[model samples]
Target: AQSVTQPDIHITVSEGASLELRCNYSYGATPYLFWYVQSPGQGLQLLLKYFSGDTLVQGIKGFEAEFKRSQSSFNLRKPSVHWSDAAEYFCAVGVREGFKTIFGAGTRLFVKA
Candidate 1:
């Protein structure tokens, strides 16, 4: 069975500051990893994914993540954040042969001006 854990339930960041969200997973095989963001009253959008090579992967809105196999971690990072970036971020692990996905509780990002 595959599972994911997100330590932070919420985070606040001043506009233009850096951001990092933690993630950890447990799976028997190589799992499909993904980070998604959802704005208020909006659908979730894919930020990035890790399936194969290159431990570090970049995504939209100036977001990036590094997949660490040893630590079973995949943490999201941003050099600088904007007020518009305030939203709920979820760390999920995808499994083959299933349409459903297991999502973490989520980290709600608050952007301060």
Candidate 2:
């Protein structure tokens, strides 16, 4: 079975500090990986995604991620985080057909001023 895992339940970081959110996935083959953010009651927004090509991918809101096929991990990173970055981050894996996506439990990010 395919699944996504976010080891961190919550993370607190000071404004302007760098942030890294870990994500791991288990699948029979390399699947489409994604990073999404949900702010409060808002819908999940795509931060970044990896399907093929370069392992490093840039995303919205100063976010970036690197996909490691060996480790089956796709970690999200930010050089500088803002207070507005506080939100729930989810790591997901999906298939090209039907676009069925499975999301991780999610990691809540807390930004401190």
User: Which ranges in model 1 have alpha carbons more than 4 Å from their true place?
Assistant: 97-99
The Cα local distance difference test for each model comes to 0.93, 0.95
Question: Per-residue lDDT for 1-113 in model 1, tens only?
Answer: 77899999999999999999999998877878999999989899999999999999999989999999999999999999999999999999887757547788899999999
Candidate 2: clashing pairs of residues: none
- For all predicted structures, in order, the TM-scores are 0.95, 0.96
By summed lDDT, the worst window of 10 consecutive residues in model 2 runs over: 94-103
Q: Which stretches of candidate 2 lie over 4 Å from their true place?
A: none
**Candidate 1 local lDDT, residue 81:** 96
